[model samples]
Target: MKKVTSDTEQQSLFWLIKTNSGRLSEADIQNFKIWLKASDDNHKAFRKASLLWRTLAYAPTLSEQPKLLEPEKKLRKKRQINSWYAVAASLVICMFITLMPELEQPTAPSEAEIVSTLELRTAKDEIRQFTLLDGSKVWLGAGSRLLVKLGSSSRHTQLLIGEAMFDINPNPQLPFYVQAGDADIKVLGTIFEVQKRNSGILVKVAKGKVRVAAQNQYRYLEMNESIHFEKNKVLPLPSKINPESFAQWRSKRFHFVNTQLKDVLHKLNRYYKSIIYIDDPSLGDIPITAAFQLNQLEQLLNSLSSIHNFSWHKDVYGNIHIKTNESEISF
Candidate 1:
């Protein structure tokens, strides 16, 4: 196979996103495989494209937008929609390549251990669902980033930040794995949710058993069981949480049972994108028992404050600052 030109590399990226957009038919998957095998350069180009895609996917989570970093000339051209926006440049080229079979056979899927990663990301107020090639399903909460790497014999996912629920297809020969914060979970076939937080990682199993390992400690959890880990320490024993109730986030509903205020806010921030800060450090340790409906953030805040005696005010920048009533003063 010949080296892929920069133009071809861009085209490979175009197809990578296109094929993964959940609209691909069975025939499309087959055609994509055929096109991929047409050249070794195609694989190399797709890998490069995947890296760039992942980086751009993560860009939205940062506080500052990336537009300021571009050169003045390029920035102006961006407004014209031909220079930086020329990702479409490769569309026609790849369409034409799909018709050509002049190259060698692509790497064999069963024998080859492909280690490329594709990322899925959600914006501040967005939730998303992703279906992997192996029929595994993922539901990602807002502001979440998940990287999936499917090998020849195993399926794996890494949660870079935020939360996700996995509905994995049963494949004994190829077990599924997830890396969340400091912990790693392995399951053969199961429904599970993993949440990563500043304090630690939490794993909840909905169906089959999951093996969680962190800091040289290993624990197994069954259906209706949940565990939290902070470094090497696992919370006393697996707690019972109704799997269905725990997955209510799928419908934008939330349930917190004696959960810490900071942890609850951590989950809410993933969905709302609002910067919430506790002006009183003692408020961080407050335990919260609450249920919330999506898009009802104001009501949720008001209800929590009614009992907790903390007043929250929104700043001009849309950030919410919560301080106890004692700390509140006239503006």
Candidate 2:
């Protein structure tokens, strides 16, 4: 029946609203029961707080019908009853007074500019290109999964299951990283390609320098250089690279320079989404040097058979199989 002004009473009211707003948790129910039974004054305080919390919903209704004020005068004749309602209303007003500034003030940048993560996925034969908030450009190849995590001081993307090309904008203050499995490709501003395959993680630097660290082994690769991670070892790829063909996947075209047949199939399969198997294992080791558009896969395979002495046919399972022709197979 008295005014609720003490910190103890306010704390009790806050907890009462918090606990009873929804179905109570086991611990909260037990705590509430214990707090309510501590003393009769606690029970009276809780009942009054609950009434006040519920009456807040009526504030708009009370405003719409100002005639309700006339009835309050009759209630005020009972000081005990009148004071209890006043205490409930005052508690709510005080709570709102404490919360208004927090609601009105602009939130902090850290809270407002949260480090949100975004995912990008490309279907077979699909390619995606976009620029990040940092002005860095990204190209996702077909059958790829990329997760972007943006931060105030850094840029990070994970090549979860496919290939991606990054043309990062220069920002020495904020480094960029592309994570592929255990390897982390760190760069400042560079054009690079990251591919994850069954063999290992492949990192190629088309421009600028890249630092690749995998399994505690680190290697710095410069422009037109590449590295392959096989388990824990970092193997530098000294093979010839065609800079013009780099990131050609963005256009659904790929260029190869003496790339192995098996490796070529592996890369092409990502775009074609079809299984092209070599019936003879030896065929996999044959080198291929060519440029082909993704849509011209059938023509490319037929062209390979002309010079490579291999025959390809689609089996019942809808898979393409290539094998050495005995008549043309070199001894």
Candidate 3:
């Protein structure tokens, strides 16, 4: 086997094999998480190694060995055998030369074909757009993480955190599914936005229709309809909303109608350089209606302070603190 020069890459490959083995205990997962968060280099190396492993695992193999040949052909045969051995050795070095014992090995070439996997992410203040292999489009919001998997029969995605807008291509034969928090959103073709909040998951439909399933119950939402699920329990009824106004964040502007102050602060924190702290927990539940560009956070907060009888001041650390005019508590 060829020596892997980079220690990070070698360790990443080992972890990848162990994770795919389907036998990791809870403690093992925690340790892996710690290792993954130790450095950006470790994360990148693991992603690279995972891609390589998946590609090789699904590659086609020779059906039969070549027969004995004449003297001249023996040299060619030797080179071919050496190449195969090299490939095998590399896989062994990665500790996944064959399928893990727990995994059922594929008996047919079709079953061995690889499913395409992609990981998409955005920086705290950045938004990104992606086009999947199936021609569906995704717009990931700031500080979001998404994992997409494309297979012959289905297109699936998981919104690990934050928000995304999906414009799915119509394909009845190949359905589209999104797993966000505890909710499962299924659709044939539609345009929708999904935001995973600290309190729940919110789904708003702009076009076509979608089925949101959670907690053994499901609701079908049509155009201009929206629903929120809390703790994996479906809401009683869907709400009517303006689709155009609901998606204004895609243009760097936001529209909020009767939104809680805490939720507003949570979204704005993704774009703000410093934290916005509400001194009183009860103040967070105050309903607020506002519309502004991403750059106008301070101005909007100032205007709200006068109307809501609240005062805000910046601490020495540059963090903004909001409190009611009657309270004198200090952080």
lDDT tens readout by residue for model 2, 1-331:
5344643364456556556568666545654565567568778877886776777533333334435456776444445454666676667666744632211211122433437578988887678887887788888898899988776666677899878999999886566778888877777447989988766887788888876765433455778877766664434433446677567778878877677899888877777767788879899988998888877888988998998878888867767888888734321
lDDT of each: 0.71, 0.70, 0.75
Error of 3 at 86 (Å): 62
Residue 46 of model 3 has an lDDT of 90
lDDT by residue (125-151, candidate 3, tens digit) is 778899888888999888889988777
* Global Cα lDDT for candidate 2: 0.70
Weakest 10 consecutive residues, lDDT, candidate 3? 100-109
RMSD of each: 21.4, 19.6, 17.3
* Top-lDDT structure, candidate number: 3
Candidate 1 weakest ten by summed lDDT: 100-109
Clashes (backbone N, CA, C under 3 Å), per candidate, total: 1, 0, 0
My TM-score estimates for the predictions, one after another, are 0.60, 0.54, 0.60
Q: Model 3, 36: alpha-carbon shift in Å?
A: 49
Clashing pairs in model 3?
none
